[model samples]
Target: MIRLVTLQSGIAQGLLWAILTIGVYITYRILDFADLTIEGTFPLGAAVTVVLINSGMNPFLATAVAMLAGPLAGLSTGILNTVFKIPGILSGILSMIALYSVNIRIMSDKATVAIAGNSIKKIVATLFPAGTVSNTLSTTVGIIVCAALIATLYWFFGTETGCAIRATGNNSKMSRSMGINTDMMTIIGLMLSNAIVALSGSLIAQFDYGSALVNMGQGTIVIGLASVIIGEVILIHKEHNFAYRLFSVVFGAIVYRTIISVVLTISGFKATDIKIITAIIVAIALSIPVFKEKAAMRKKRNLAMKEGK
Candidate 1:
């Protein structure tokens, strides 16, 4: 029963992170750039949301402010990369590094804040009244919100600007020739991606009944990347429907968390080994294509041997 609860908790955590992974996909996959600002921006959102909620601000409004902050972080990186001619990856690294201090300031140098007694939780308690049932309701509400946001994103990506963003990603030189401002497209793409990321952070802070802490975003990009790769692995031979691909990311995140929960339940491994496990999963996912090629070659060799016999 404890193991089952652990598994459920993992799934819940993963579902929350699925939003961040999808945000990462926008820049990493769609825009073809690394926007490491997500590391700082994610925790920034949480911090801002917690601070506002603690000061008696509206929860929804606080969440909105947090979401807005994420895009601005991306914009800073975008300008650094595009305007100053810095490499995209390097610009993102610089921005992320800068955000470390910014996040510290935002959190008022606290390592962690206990949001368990906050108004957000109180409001939910009032509504649900039941103990575990309130937690369930909060999770359900969050899932619904995430689902709606994902659907809206799917629709937006089908728009003209979104198509241009995709085109710029596929070939910036061609997009330039077509008179689309590739620089602007990059900025817009990063902005949108980080907005989603921050929104995820806000939801996480509120849901977990915790305040944002600096460095909370460590390994976040890797987790997101892992989710994407896991999703791809599952859909390796599946059709290329965009909606399916998007949902697969969410599914992958949940599965990844499920795996972690199972691992954590095993007494042999320390909780700190999560990063090691995450790296292993990512390495395996990345090696899949090479493995597939080797398998094909072996099959061909066997066919030749049969013919010779």
Candidate 2:
């Protein structure tokens, strides 16, 4: 019974974290750049939302405001990367380092701030009520929000500018030759990616943890990359469909969470072993493609030898 509950909780957590993974996908996969600002943006969104809510702002409006907070951070990275010619990863690191102090200020210089007041703390808490299984509501909300974002992204990415952004990621030089402004595309992509990432921070802070902690986003990049890699492994053949890829990312998070939950429940692995588990999962998932390619090459060599014989 406890295992069942744990599994259910894992699924819920996966659903929530999937938003962050999708956000990571925009820059990591879509734009083909590294942006570490998400580590700060995640908790930044949370801090902004919680502070605003505690100050008597409407939860919905406060959350919306938090969503906007991410793009500014992205914009900073964009300017640093595109204008100053700093590397993408370094630009992101600078923004992330700066956001740490910003987030601390937003949280009123506190380490953590708990959700307060009579307003709905969790986004879907009203639907679940106090005593019901929290996982069900979380799953439902996750499905709704993720599906909506995916659908919206599908339509947006099919447009001319979206195609240009995708092209820029594919080959910036070719995109430049084709008269697309690669720098602007990178900026837009970074902005869009961080926007989604910040929203995830807001939602996760409000929906799951019920508090905004300074270190909530610690090592988030690994988890996001892990989820993306896991999803790609399972849906390796669906690379052509953007929507399908996004769905895979969402599913990957769930699978990642489920694996962790199962291991902790059945094995002697403590909760603290999660980071190592994540690292192992990511490493194994990453090697799958290499392994496949080697196997294919060996098979081809064998066939060639047979023919020669």
Candidate 3:
């Protein structure tokens, strides 16, 4: 049944993944690297957070610890790429493969770790003391985290270091010529990206999934890329502002999840078909610019023909 609850859950899930999209945006867009490490980083965050929560650590502190753990993976990728002279994509891939084992270790060699009983204090619980695992509570937690993330990112990107990172992404050679340590910028950007990816995983474990599964983050990189592409399509004037683009990415994630939810409800789409749907969505979104260019060319051709006639 396509109930209101379903829509709310979709929105909430979108919000959580929006954080992941932002993390991906930093590495893919800002650092100009396809960081596959994020695929493993997400689940690592969830596994670490869940384990800490089960061990009776404060949820906020547990989340922080998990967030910090993300940078270690990023650092490994960075070292491989920068120091060992590995290609960016291959370095990220190697780190991601290694993280699967690391995530397993974090989960105590378990495939899944469930957050335990009433003794656990998660962020959503702290936000709504009286409420059960309702859509409203989940949505609130998502909103709070998303808002804080956006504001912090916006401010950070305006700083000198952030500008250097962007410059590195835009033109590494030019940035190097300009006396910026492009290598450091790339490492910092990756670290920042994976940190947020980890944060999203932690919140998902606590707020949405209520359990940490090793394979839960599979195919997440594509989802993040699709979300970013959808946002670019929605915002026609993407050059106007950085903040707007970030906001659009969040909107894109929500819209994509809502569409999926509706499809699942109305068409009886299998849960396993989600990857196929995501692939279709990305293909369509990516083709929009080419379609627009073709239309403009056709219009100009007709106008030129009429003037010649």
> Using lDDT as the measure, which candidate wins?
2
How many pairs of residues collide in each model? 0, 0, 0
- Decoy 1 TM-score against native: 0.93
- Superposed by TM-score, candidate 1 places the C-alpha of residue 44 at a distance from the truth, in angstroms, of 0.7
Question: Compared to the true structure, candidate 2 yields what TM-score?
Answer: 0.93
Q: What's the TM-score of every candidate structure?
A: 0.93, 0.93, 0.93
Give the alpha carbon lDDT tens digit for every residue of 112-196 in model 1.
7545435454566667746665346546765776688778878888998888999999999999999999999999999999998
Worst 10 residues of 2 by lDDT: 117-126
Q: Could you arrange the candidates by lDDT from highest to lowest? A: 2, 3, 1
At residue 260, give the lDDT of candidate 1: 86
- Candidate 3: tens digits of C-alpha lDDT, residues 132-234: 6656665777788888888999999999999999999999999999999999999999999999999989888887778899998898988999988887777
Q: What range of 10 consecutive residues in model 3 has the weakest lDDT sum? A: 117-126
- Native-structure RMSD, model 1: 2.0
